[model samples]
Target: MPDQPVDQTTPRRGSRLSVDDWLEAATQILVDDGIDALKISRLSARLGVTKGSFYWHFTDIGALKSALAEHCRQSQATAASRIEALASLPPVERVEAMARLLSDPRRWAMESALRRWAVTDESIAASVDQLDCRIFAIAISAMRELGFSETEAHARATTLLYAGIGYVHAHGRLNEATVDDLHVIIEILTRR
Candidate 1:
């Protein structure tokens, strides 16, 4: 029997996959498993599609990896924008909001995964470092708004950023208690 013609447009189950869908699946896999688990075969399986669909969206694994890092960078920028939008709020309140945003479990996992990936990938390391600097700058700006001089604000923001990262790393998941603890830390940091 002659082979049946294959549909090139429609994906498996007639579900067309977009680039965002692929990126999201990649991010989830990266977070759930590790960098090594983010292969094209695995992502295609997770998305219920074929390698052709993956290739349709990304040129190769390297391109997919770059897209993942860019996606993460954009996510961080969105979070930073949220904090920046709260500029009208008191500095302490702004800090609390930033803390709440950073304590999100999904974000924590993504950051942890990226940190692990950075250990072996110099490009990813640079991206992660840039993200850290952007976050720190947002914190410092918030601190300066609270009447602290630039130097003091930088120092306080550095401490707060490190403490927040440590807290999230230790907890892995945030709850009311963690949030309350975070508020206390913010209070102490921002105290005159």
Candidate 2:
């Protein structure tokens, strides 16, 4: 017998999409259509499944939004962990890695979307604020590893993070010129 092509339009009677799948679809919708488009019906249509599948994964719309926020928080934590693990590398190299990570287009889109969402939601605003602090702490620690005093490292980390955020907001995508400019900025910021 030959294998049949799976039909995405209709899921099997007893099978359903995972929570991750729904989240990914919601993220995509959030990125492309903004928070207003992140409703369960829209996500179900995007995923080619039914609203029942979403309910199976999430108790309600609020639960889904909380899950999405948690996902973003986890992603930031993972990035911070990776940056911390790069302590063995030169401080300049570590700063460059962090710059590249911040400049990533996908991350920028998700961040921009979340920032937009945060404006109207206090919970999301709190999460964003916390994530920003964690990122700054990681950057400051990396600068300290490069022999910078605590105060100087804090100032430098603040400068680097602000510059990166400004660049991301001003130009969501990086070009060669931006990459070269980033290298220069990292060099200056990490200079001991």
Candidate 3:
């Protein structure tokens, strides 16, 4: 007898996708199609696994959502750490560096999608709120180094934070011209 070709359509009793695999797929689905697309059935089909595989990792959709929240938090922390590394630089350079990094389209899309989802989802909203504070703290610190008073820095940081996020979402690109315009905006906001 010869070895048989395994039938991929059949769900093997012990075969299953790992938690990381699930998270990756879930993240892609969310990024591509939004939170509504994260159904277990869809994920099983997408991953070539059975619903049992998903169930093995998560007890329910809520459990999966909780995992997703944690993943988002981790991602935000990673990005913030990268931004925080610029603290050693002068204020203007720090702000410019952060702006340029964030202005890329792909990065903008990821952040925007997560933010839009958070707008309606309470769980995501809470996670985003925490992320927002971390982002604000860095921006304010940079503004203060640029000669703005504490109150002025906070106000300017908050304004620019909203503007940068909105610009990426609305314009989809922060090219040289856009970045130049943003610099003007920053100047206006930080002016005493």
Whichever of 1 and 3 has more lDDT, that candidate is 1
1-192 per-residue lDDT for model 1 (tens digits): 999776553345448888988888888888888888889988887777778878988899999998987887677667657756766677777778777877776677777887788888887787777767766877898888889998899999999889766755665465433667777788888988
* lDDT of each residue in 1-192, candidate 3, tens digit only: 998786664444456567887888788888888888889998887777778778889999889988987888788777777877877877777777777766666676678778878987887777667667766877899888778888889888898788777765775354433767767775676556
- Give the better candidate number (1 or 3) by TM-score: 1
Q: Candidate 1: deviation at residue 98, Å?
A: 1.3
Q: Give me candidate 3's TM-score against the actual structure.
A: 0.76
Between candidates 1 and 2, name the one with more favorable lDDT.
1
For residue 43, model 1's alpha carbon misses the true position, in angstroms, by 1.4
lDDT of each: 0.78, 0.77, 0.76
Q: Using Cα atoms with residue i matched to residue i, what is each candidate's TM-score against the true structure?
A: 0.77, 0.76, 0.76
Clash number for each model: 0, 0, 0
TM-score (C-alpha, index-matched) for candidate 1: 0.77
Q: Candidate 2's residue-wise lDDT over 82-177, tens digit each?
A: 656765667677778878877776677777777788888787777677767766877888889889998999999999888766765665365423
Model 3: residues with Cα > 4 Å off, grouped in runs: 1-16, 171-192
lDDT of 3: 0.76
Candidate number achieving the greatest TM-score relative to the actual structure: 1
Worst 10 residues of 3 by lDDT: 168-177
